[model samples]
Target chain A: MASNIPEKYKTLIKNNKRIDGRTLDELRPVKIKVGVIPSADGSAYIEIGNTKVLAAVHGPKEMFPRHMINEDRAVLNVRYAMLPFSTSERVRPGPSRRSNEISKVTRHALESVIFLEEYPGMGIDLTLDIIQADAGTRATAITAASVALAHAGIPMKGLVAATAIGKINDRLAVDLNGPEDNFGQTDMPIAMISTNKNITLLQMDGDFSKEEFKTALSMAKKAIEPLFEAQRAALQKYYK
Target chain B: MTLLYQNMQYIRNNIAKNREDGRTSEQFRDITIETGIIGRAEGSARVKIGDTEIIAGVKMEIGTPFPDSPGEGIIMVNSEFSALASPDFENGPPREDSIELSRVVDRGIRESKTVDVEKLCIEKGSKVWMVFVDITIVNHDGNLIDAAGIGAITALLTAQIPTINEDGTLNREEFVGSLPIKEIPVPITSGLINNTIITDMTKDETECSDAIFTVTTIENENYCAMQKAGPSEMTEKQMLDIANIAQKESKKIRSAIKATVKKHKI
Candidate 1:
C-alpha cells in the first residue's frame, strides 16, 4: 500500500533536515493568552503554528440532569468543536464520532490535576473552539484550557501542557504541522502536568519502533519546558 | 420556552400578525451560509439562521456496494443534536428527534437525485464510494430541519472525493474531483400556533406551536419530500397553502446555495 509518505519528505529526511528547515528537536512558535472571553469564568487563546484554539472554563457549578451529578467529586465535561471556518474545508458544526471520545480523554487529562472533591455535585465545563486548525489542534486546545482553568482559580495539582512529537519520513520531529501530520509515519499527542512528570494524556497511531517511541516521548517531555513557560507567562500577564 | 407558554394568548395574537421576534408569518430568519470550512473532510459548510447554527461535513471513503444496489454509491446522513447546543438536547447516542431529522433530510436529497450515485461506482460490486454527510447542531434556536437541510446540500455540493492510493487507502492530501451531483434540494418548514401559521419557529416559539410541517423542493420545480409533526390536524387548504409557500420560498434558498458554492469553488 502506498502510505502518505511522499518522496520529497523522505529525501529531506535522508539529508538530516525537515521540509520546514527545522532540526530534529526544533519547534514551531507558540503563543498563548489567558482570559480572552469576558463572559466565561476563565478563557484562553493559543496559537501553535497555524492552529489557533480558544478555550473557556465555565463554572465549577451545579451538574444538571440529575444522573450526571456526582456526590463525592465534581465531573468534568469537555466539548471540542472545530469551527466551520477553522480548516481549508469547512467542518460541520457539531461533534463528530471522534469528538465524544476525545472529550473523554481530555476530561481524564484535566481531572488528574483538578481538586474535584472540593466541588461535589458540580461540573467544570471546558469548551475548546479551534478557530483555525492545521494539526494537533486538540493538544493545543488542552494546553490553553489548562491555563484557563488555572486563571479561574480552580485548585489543581499543577498546570498542564500538551504537545505532539512524531516521526516524519523516518526523522523524529517536534510539533508536526498540517502536512507532516498527514504524511508522518507515527504521531503521539500527549498531555503532561509540568511538575509531576506524569503523562496525563496519551494516544498514538501509525508505526513507531520502541526506541523511536522513547525518543518521541522524551522530545515531548523537553518541549513542555517552553510550553509550560508560555502558559505561566499568559497567566502572569492576566494578573499584571 | 415557558415564557411563551405562560403567555399563551399573546403567542396566538402575535403569530396571527407578526412572529414573536417580529418576522412576518411567511418570512424566514436571517441566514448566513458559507462553504468549504473543514480541511479533513471532503466538503463542509457552516450555516447560521438567526441564533440557530449548524455545521455540515461530507467525507468519502471506499467501501463495498450495498447488496440491493451493487452499481451505485451510498450517501448517509447523520444528525447530532448536541447537548451543549440547548438545554433540551442530550449528550449520548442519537435521540429520536435527530434520527427523524436525518432521515427526512436524507430522503429529500435521495429522492431528488441530488447526487448521481451511479457515477460513484469504482467497480461493479467490489468497491464503490460512500459519502458521509454529518450535520451537527451548534446552537438550537428552532427550525433545525431547514438549517440542517441547507447545511447538508451545501456541503455535498462543495465536497471532493479524496484520491485513492494504488492499494486502496486514501491520499488525504489530494483530491480526485467533486462528488457527482445532479441538483440541489432546499427544505422549507412552517408551524402553526393558535391556529396561526408561522415559518421558522424558534425554541420559544416552538412551545406555542400546535402543528409543524416541512417540505423540500428541488430547484423550485418539484416536491421531493415532506414531513409533518405535532398532535394537531391540518386542513386540506392549509396543507396546499404550505406547499405553495414552501415551493416559493425554496427559490430564494436555492439561489443562496448556488451563490455560496460558486463563490468558494474548488
Candidate 2:
C-alpha cells in the first residue's frame, strides 16, 4: 500500500483540526478506577478512550532469591501483557520484542517516581496487564500503575504520569491511538514525575525530523499534566 | 521399631480425622486475584490461592495467519515458573510442569469457545490478529490451575476489541467492545491428603499432601475437565467426595471473580 497523505488531514492540520475533528492539543476522555483488585496490595484500572490497562502492586518484602542484596533500594519487577482480543486481531502469547522493550522502559519510568531507597533489601513487584490495546499501552500502564501502588499504601516519592505524542502527515498529535500509530511518521512515549516535572523516560520509534521530534516532545510534556490529574482524581474517587 | 511405626500411623490417623489447617475435610482456604497487573498486556490478572500466586497477561498484535487457520485468529497461552518461585524451576525453556499448566488452562478456555476467533479476523485468508496470553507464576504455593483459570477468564472478560473501519483504517477512539464470551469457566482444585479431600488447598498443604485434583467448573452446572496431578490413585468413593466438594466450592470461586470485576467498576 502506498503511503499517500490524506489531503483532508493536511488541510485539517493547517486549520488545527484532528482526525476526529478535535483541536490539535485536545485529549480523548479518560476514566480511572483504583483499588480495583482487592487481593493486590494496590491496584488500578485505567481507560483512555479505547485503550485499557490494569496495574497491580505487590510486596515490599523478600529480596528476589538471587539478586545481590542491597541495603538501600527495592527491586521493581515489571511485566506488560496484552490480551489477544485487546485489538482488532489476535496477538501471539508471550513477550514480543516490542512488549519486552516496553516492560523494561516502563520499569525505568516508574523507578524514577518511587523512593526505592526507602526499603532496601526488599522487592516490590509491579505488573501492568493490558486488557485491551489501543495505542498508548506503555504510557497508560505507567500512569495507572502508579495510582495502584499508592493505593496499595506503598510509599512512593510521587506519581509517574505518561503519554504519547506523535507526528502524522506533518502534524503533531498527542495520545496517538493504534491507527494513528501505525500510519503516523513518528511516535514518542514520554513519562514524567508529577511532583517536580522531571522527565524520567523518553522513547521514540519511527522516523522524525529534528523539528518534528522537538514539537512532539513539548506536546508530550504538556500531555502528561492531564494524566497526572487523572491519576490524582482516580485516587480521590476510590479513597473517598 | 514397632512403637515408632505405630506413632507415625497414629499421626496419620489424627490428621485424617482433623485437618492441619483446622478446617474440615471439605473446607477451602481463602482465595483472591486482581485483574490487570501488567500494563503492556491488553488484559491481565494476578491470582492468589492462599500462597500460590499466578499472574496472567493478554496482549494483541496483527500478524500473518498460520498456514491452516487463515480466516480465524488465534489465542495462545504460555506459562513460566520463575526460579524465584521455586528452586525446581530451571532458567531455560518452559519445563514440563509449566507446559502442563498452560495446556490445561488453554484447554478449558479454547475448548469452551470462550473467545470468538472468527470475529478477530482482520483480513481473512491472509492476515489475522493473534491473541497472546502469558501466565507467570510469581509465588508457587499450590493449585495453579484454579488461579490461572480465573486470571485467564478475568483478563478475557475485561478485554476489548478495537473498531476496524471499512476504509482499511482503525477507529482508535471507537471502542467496538469485548469479544464474545460464551461462558465464564472456573476451575476448582482440591487436595487429597490421607483419604481426606479439602477445597482450595494452600501451598503448605499441597506440598504436604499425597494428591491434587482440579475440577473445571463451567457454566452453572457442568464440569469441563477433571485433572489429577499426583502419584496416588483415588477410589470411586473418594472421587465422589471430591466431585461433591468441587460442585459446591466452585460457586464461591465464581462469585469472587464477579465481585472483583464489579468492584473494579470496569
Candidate 2 lDDT by residue in tens digits, A63-133: 77645466778888888888788877787878764566466667767775677888888888888889888
Candidate 1 residues B203-249, lDDT tens each? 77887776677777777355666666553444434555676788788
Candidate 2 local lDDT, residue B163: 61
Best by lDDT: 1
Q: What is the DockQ of each candidate?
A: 0.01, 0.01
lDDT of 2 at A187: 62
Overall lDDT per candidate, in order of appearance: 0.80, 0.71
Deviating ranges (above 4 Å) for candidate 1: A1-240, B1-4
lDDT of 1 by residue, A1-240 (tens): 123345665454546667777777777789988888999998999999899999999999888656989889888888888999988777888877556556656776777688899999998889999899999988898899999999888998888888888767667888888878876665667777877656666555544443555566677879878999999988888899
Give candidate 1's error at residue A235 in angstroms: 76
B1-266, model 2: which lDDT tens digit per residue?
Answer: 11244544554566667665687766666778686566555667888877778888877767777655677888888788888886656688765567667766876676556777877888987768778888888887667778888898888876666566777565544557775677777767776667677766655556555556665656655555545555343443454456566667778878888887666533
Q: Report per-prediction Cα RMSD to one decimal.
A: 20.0, 22.2
Q: What DockQ class does candidate 2 belong to?
A: incorrect
